[model samples]
Target: MPDAMKILLFLLTICLGSIIMQPSVAQTVVNKPSAATADTVTVRGRVTDAQTKQGLPGVTVLVKGTALGVSTDTNGFYKLVVPSIRAVLTFNSVGYATVERKLDAKATGARVVNVALHPDTKALQEVVVTGGSPSQALMGSVSGVQSQAAHDRKQKRGGVSVQIQGISSMPRAPWYGRSESYATIQENSFHTARKEPLSTFSIDVDAASYSNVRRFLNDGQRPPRDAVRIEEMINYFTYDYPQPAANEPFSVTTELATCPWNPKHQLLQVGLQGKKVETSNLPAANLVFLVDVSGSMSGPDRLPLVQSALRLLVKVLRPQDRVSLVVYAGAAGVVLEPTPGTRRADILDAIDRLQAGGSTAGGEGLRLAYSTARKYFNKEGNNRVILATDGDFNVGEQSDAAMERLITEERESGVFLTVLGVGEGNLQDKKMELLADKGNGNYAYLDNLDEARRVLVRQFGGTLFTIAKDVKLQLEFNPARVQQYRLIGYENRALADEDFNNDRKDAGELGAGHTVTALYEIVPVGAPPVVDPLKYQANPAVAPASATADVMTVKLRYKEPQGSTSRLLERALRGTATPIVQASENLRFAAAVAQFGMLLRQSDYRGSATFETTAKLAEGARGKDAEGYRAEFVRLVKTAEAARRPTEDPESYGVR
Candidate 1:
């Protein structure tokens, strides 16, 4: 087998045999025009979503009618250099409209451009409603509006609104196939950490949405296309972390391609293996299912999705794994107890008979799930309580603080928790996140069957496996040789300088074969920093280092899977960058995404970034977008900028 294919198989075996879910490496579409003859002019821009004010990942910046375009990297940044300074850049995406901006002749001296995209279509026709009223779409940002030309600033919702509407237990039998759309909505919100201050985002898909999409289409007008939530996508993949072996059972691959529709924005294709674990080798899992069968779950995406996803998981339990079911509505009750995993029929039978009703007694259900799990705890086996809900735990422990405390106590009992979120409208990601972080477990949203398979079946191990604990990173830059550096993303994941060595410090987890990449867009002493002039007085006493260094040293600290004490791993990034006379595909993709994000938030530090330059640079980086996702990214960039048109009147849109 080819080396890459062989590596893929090996990883797949590891995934199937072990337990732990891994993260995606993040890919990009390079728009680097051939250096040989193309009259390449670099473009730099920030790509961000207008609604959540978050960076738009894998956005494409393209020069219309040419293969000249690039895709954003994991950081939602990109840089492309095109063949001509006068080329027009386009932006497009799945649910967003198309946009474009032109690069004038004065390209070299051009600064960074920021692009913000508003949510375009929230097909009110579909039963699954995500975001806000169409009329409300244009009001996302006061800045975007005040900055926009009066004529163009008019939309119902200027910004995107993402939220969980509520739980619906109603049947969506006919439209089950389209459920992935709602699933993606949850994933998108979760992945973004739901930190964007969206003015109107809400997840309001009715349980009837599954069937309603087709019904809406039958009347001539098409229903709204469900936005696929990717957070759920990654969380769904089950990884087998730290399970050393000759091969892995599954592998995940991300590809950047041109979108089949839009020529500007790029398409990012994330795929995983399809396999099942044997009934044997599986641990004796004491699983207590905390299902929110409240009246709120009366929709197809809520109760039905939860029931269907659970049924899929039930089928995998072996005779050795013990199962229990706890349901919460007006009252919490144990529907099943200590059932054998091998008795799949019995477990699913119980699930099949469940019905949603009454108020959500979420706290009561938690107490019961814990009580049940502790009763069946195995010293040498897996023990966990999985909560399936839309996050409307209103009846009990409704506050985030209460949920945090409960999760903290649950972790002490040696019974981990995994949250399988369903539906959109009423999800409380903040509460679910707290539960997962404190409980030493994880959280996910089950948007559809594809997602269910990705999370429950394909990545069962990684999702359940614990390899290392308290993973933290401390980059010790040799200040003597360096000027200044910035750490991208991880705003919330950042660790205090002291947290690096503290073994007890809780931090992000990395699954086996999972890669956590952080970039330090640095400025050498000789080079200018992204930050403006020092805000404080200069340290005259502190002498600069005499010698110059090429790269920074990175130190990684992690604890053994079961051991609390910490361990250390170190690696140094070394390369002699010759002033970057010209940029590469990789460099531009990251830069573009960053710029796009900065633009969206009107970040103070988006130096040298502009939609025009970003477009040109992204145009330079379109490297092998076999699936066309990258090309689509460029289009997304254009569509976003055009929607809020930075070109019509740059000052009004605050392009500076």
Candidate 2:
């Protein structure tokens, strides 16, 4: 064939082939999905209250139809990737009206989509109109809806009837129904020096109350009165008390000053400084992490924070230290066996793999942890179980009494416990305290990551190593000098005068380099007494002793952790009363904390103790705040002050 004819014939064949292949090519192009990244866009914004402009935390942000969703951070910030610009984003919270925002299809780079949610005011009215009490109506509505959904789901599946036992019957729990446990505290009344000359109590070194109080303040709520443990508040910050001398595990110092709240009264300050042992000289640690991976702990501030905190603690462990991990959720199991601290990666991997889902079996976890600790019991080492949980024990043996008995039994095995609480809503503070008190351990609430660092990193030595156990204090006040006196706090720690002499009684343990402070408000002979004079049983004050120039005598008893016998140390308070301005920085700061606690508790004894006064005292006495803990206390005080200001129109927290 000629070259022109061949080329024309080839072009015609190519055109026919192209026409035949066009349908397939078009079909392939149509079936192939576009790149997700090219179509989807990142939406970043914050959620806040419309009226107050305050960020609303724990708000759920989601795509209208997809399962993809995210909860807001503590700062009420969120980031979400959407399938398309036309997609609608929905934001919902417990007490706020639900909102939806449609993304602009034409928008290009990361779009900002901030939203202000209004309070759900109509919810209460709606519930009230349901022809029942507000609470009953609201709960009934929720239950009815959930029941209908379950019924529909059952009908869809061949009309088969099925019931899930032990599952939460309600689809959603009431927002306000979340409850925290706190022990009832009966404030101490004045004890006439003549009748009750000997004031005895166990020394409390736990600082859980301070961080717990800070949590309430941060959440814009006043903490419950029972949650305010004055002694813990005062001892949270490290004081500059002198360490123990030769042959002593701790040193006691005393100061007398005019009470900040009541000028007519005097304050007796007793401070104990535990001897600090070098980290190198400390005993090898055998630690078992009793972590709760329960469903309630499924939040950033709960299990995730616990993992981070444990990681920080792991970084400080030495080769001599050994760590084991035991997790409990519906049941207890050992995630990691006894492993050397050198194998940090293994421990971390175990921790990172932990997921939250199931009821908490805290009692079983404790039993397993104590058993694990005993299996590798370090005779000359720090054998301890660090229980990290939100304190929501819901499974077998969940009662506080049962847990107390279990802890007491395990404590006899010579294994100490460290209860590190995280999260809120269902925090069993009372149970935590009971376990720590009975199990020879200390309780601390880690409200945030910073607190975890503070407890696990900055104060590592004191947090893990106990130098002295069963430490008790007994004070004898001279009736001639102090007509009446009242202990500032330690309502739970207060012991009968005779209990101090009992060696078998369990008291608080003092960790290495830990500081304990106690305050006493004294009413002199001239000061007015809250109690009226007794007509029938008149107790006369003893004559002033001319020989001994002492107002009171303090006696402390403590046992070397391994020893069954306790050693006693006595000191007399004889110094002249110093004005608040002239008092030691430690005394001043502690007094400020006591006053601040009183204010928070709304105690009647908080005479002239305004938040301003507390702030001023704390600011002036924030000495050698190398870790800025005292500074943080000042900030918290300021926050509390702002929260306490009376408002005619209070902000509704949208609890339904």
Candidate 3:
């Protein structure tokens, strides 16, 4: 063997080793960590509307030329860790122009960079008009069409002038896609306590309406009239009610005061506070996550938010809990089989892998979820199907009646439902509310990640565990003390007098740590009669008990979460009416919320209620708000007030 040849081979091997050891160009471009890499710098700031100067939530902030990104919180605040001080950050959000900010290359330590984004008028102007004639197209471009037939008729009138006139006369589309639907709510009217002595209704704990209204107000749009469920809005905020007694499931508190909106009338606030149970003491849970990955849910606020939300839930799950993931798009299928919550990583990984596309088969998804829950039914534990969707059921039994029937049947299996509605424009709120009510569960609307955290993390026990079911309230107003009374809100929850005592009748459920409230506007015997004295019938005689100081008798019926038979609870409220200024924070806050709802709904009985009055009331009643939710509510009232004012420059008003 020649020594020269061996030496040459050795040199070639050394060259190959050197080449392999050197980092690739792509890795260097991506700023891969290395011994010489600079320490990470923390970047934090807020994104705001340029005109309104208000925080812009749900904005996406990203490191330029990299995959690293984070969304702003509810207040448009974001914090990100960058590999180097020289990194450039980009801010993007719906309806707003994108922005880019570059950090100082020589700067060290944490950096703060606030950004303001302007509304994108071009993006706002974009609309979809399908299968329309040239004249109809012109009309659509001028003023959005309400229906095809109406536009066609306007087109037949002929001439550009006529077409323009018709366009001006045409009504604007309720929404671009016109897909959102809300149940029509007829405001409760005053009823003479003499003729109708009993007021009965199912207790409601659902707060979807409040968040949904916030979404609309934040976008600088007035929510639809039907979307304002006064009862839900009133109950969205938690009241500082005392805990139940050791032997009871909940505590009842009642306050009577002069109505804020009407000094002539009295306001009666009835609150029930459920016992708070520690998470450690909660029963083991068998949860089926029924996620909608339909095309409509492809928006950032939909499927992606749902994924993030479920991830938060998974982090809090215990070893005794079991989780299953089921997703629906064009079809429904199980993505992950029943697995113990101890395997958090596995559940999270499955959730991360979810992507959105295809039509929504919500009905099929519900059916599949319930079946999966039944298959692994936890007899002694909590069994629930958590459905997260936009509630657009386009395929396979989409009717509300059909969905009610399906949920009603499945609820008999002892598996409760939790419907989390997300997204906008095409949100079928009516359907989701109905499904939740029929399934003997609660409904919530998640508008942002902060809300997701609040629902799945902050209020874990209350959101997932039920303490009472079939809860109903009945009040008998003393004819002698009261002439007419109106039940505020609860229009849809009103139950027939007989239904209150009927055990077979389904009603609202109370979650652990939940608080339910109801309000009544009463007219004293001396107040002007709401109705003319009966034309043909004589006034009924008041009972002997009605002569007492008691103004009304309150009765409640509820059943144990797992029990079929119901138990009765009763209390009496005396005729003493406190001044509005001296009312309890609970009563004042609730009255404020009720007034807010009435103003939003433009209720016939709103009286002197205004946005200013509502905000003032809320501001005074926001006592020791630990979560800052009460503060947020005050801001929302201001936003609503600003939105209601006429403005020439919509952009200045922050119209999204």
lDDT of 1 at 506: 67
Q: Write the per-residue lDDT of candidate 1 for residues 165-259, one digit (tens) a residue.
A: 22233322222223222321211111110111111111110112222222222221222323222122122222222222334322333333322
State in Å the error of residue 603, model 2.
0.5
Better by lDDT, candidate 3 or 1: 3
Better of 2 and 3 by TM-score: 3
Pairs with backbone N, CA or C atoms under 3 Å apart (clashes), candidate 3: none
Error of 2 at 365 (Å): 0.9
TM-score of 1: 0.53
Q: What is the lDDT of residue 340 in candidate 2?
A: 95
Candidate 3 displacement at residue 366 in angstroms:
1.9
lDDT to native, each model? 0.50, 0.78, 0.80
Model 1's alpha-carbon lDDT is: 0.50
Q: For model 3, what is the C-alpha lDDT against the true structure?
A: 0.80
Alpha-carbon runs more than 4 Å astray in model 2: 1-177, 539-548, 644-651
